[model samples]
Target: MISVESAIIGLFSFSIVLLALSFFKKDKYKELENQVENLTMIVMQENYQLKKKMKVLEEELLGNESYTVPLNERYETNGK
Candidate 1:
């Protein structure tokens, strides 16, 4: 028993509300995207620094004369 005019008006009002709600969601999504990008950049920088430190440690280990000798050799040399 609903009139066609009232039904049309109700549908139009519902569509308008849905559209407005979508606009609010869009802003929140954009803000979350920016935050994720910032976090990703920070993680990338830390990874690079860790890699650099690992490379330095590898070089130091390779250059160390003491490490060139085995543990058994160290014990034998010490026992002599």
Candidate 2:
């Protein structure tokens, strides 16, 4: 027969252990979460830089006199 006092102690101990295990899980993944966050930031920055470069390239190409005209312009000039 289990005593009421022992039952209460056992329940309290189990609750404490469950809480500790939950904390341990967070600690274990803390490092991995930081790594993933760092990687995401890096990728986003690189993507933004690439977009800027591409926009500059497009503008440069458009400003170049020797760049080919669109096919529609070619057709218009040819049909003139």
Candidate 3:
């Protein structure tokens, strides 16, 4: 048989414990958020670099292909 005053005190104590637990968890949450942000930035930078490398490779392939004369043209030039 709990009295009304005892119930109120028990509820108040439970709320205080929850508040303290939340405060402790908030710091860990912030640290995890920061780690995720850092990983995202790293991934973005790597993606940009890969795109840049692909562009350079595409340009080089196009340039190399443009320099090759046709087989007939090569034969005619060499025969002359």
Candidate 4:
């Protein structure tokens, strides 16, 4: 016994509810994206620091004379 006009109104109301739910989900997705960006920046900064520390260690090791012994001389000298 439902009238055509009433059915149309009910369908419109359901559409509006679905639209609002989609909008709310979009906002939540944006918030999660911001959190991920922040965490990525922190990880990148830590990675850069670690790379710098590794470079310094490599320089120190390369600067030592004992570590630079020529291959030919090593065989000529007694295994001291």
Candidate 5:
């Protein structure tokens, strides 16, 4: 029952609506992508900082000054 001209007009209207919707959402999508990238960079920096801190702590723990008591004297000094 639809005429060719009416069908063409309907198709054009649908295309315009879709284009408008896409245009409106484009900025929001770009903003989300940028936020994700920023968050990823922050996480990577935090991970690097944590790794560096852990290395320093490990080195400090393994230093000779940490074990002030000799192995044999430890049991004699402590009741445990």
Candidate 6:
């Protein structure tokens, strides 16, 4: 048989624990969001690096060619 004061105390403590749990859950969500943003940034950096590498490779390949330019490529290069 709980006294009135004991019941009130128990309920109050329960509510406090629930609020603490909610706060921790929100913090976890923020941590996960930060991790996702970091991963996205890493992927963007990798994509930029890959594009630069591919451009260099293309230039090297083109430089090795001694043949005359194609008609379309010549027109495009002249920007007309």
Best by lDDT: 1
| Better by TM-score, candidate 4 or 1 | 4
How would you order the candidates by TM-score, starting with the best? Answer: 2, 3, 4, 1, 5, 6
**Candidate 5: C-alpha RMSD after superposition:** 6.7
lDDT of 1: 0.86
Give the C-alpha miss distance for residue 1 in model 5, angstroms: 7.1
Model 4 TM: 0.57
Residue ranges of candidate 6 with Cα displaced over 4 Å: 1-26, 64-80
**Clashing pairs in model 1, backbone N/Cα/C closer than 3 A:** none
Query: What residue runs in model 1 are displaced by over 4 Å at the alpha carbon?
Result: 24-26, 64-80
Q: Taking the tens digit of each residue's C-alpha lDDT, what string does model 5 give over 1-80?
A: 99999999999999999999987774767789999999999999999999999878866985754355666776676666
Q: Which parts of model 5 have CA positions greater than 4 angstroms off?
A: 13-25, 64-80
lDDT for each candidate structure: 0.86, 0.84, 0.84, 0.83, 0.83, 0.84
lDDT at residue 76 of model 1 (Cα atoms): 93
How many clashes would you count in candidate 1?
A: 0
* Cα TM-score of candidate 3: 0.59
List model 2 lDDT by residue over 1-80, tens digit each.
99999999999999999998887674767799999999999999999999999878877976754335776886788799
TM-score of each: 0.56, 0.62, 0.59, 0.57, 0.56, 0.49
Candidate 3, 1-80: lDDT as tens digits: 99999999999999999998887774767789999999999999999999999878866866654335766886787799
Q: Could you tell me the lDDT of residue 9 within candidate 5?
A: 100
Write down the worst ten-residue block by lDDT for model 5: 62-71
Clashes of each: 0, 0, 0, 0, 0, 0
Model 2 TM-score, 2 decimals = 0.62
Candidate 6 lDDT, tens digit per residue, 13-77? Answer: 99999998887774667789999999999999999999999878877877865335775886687
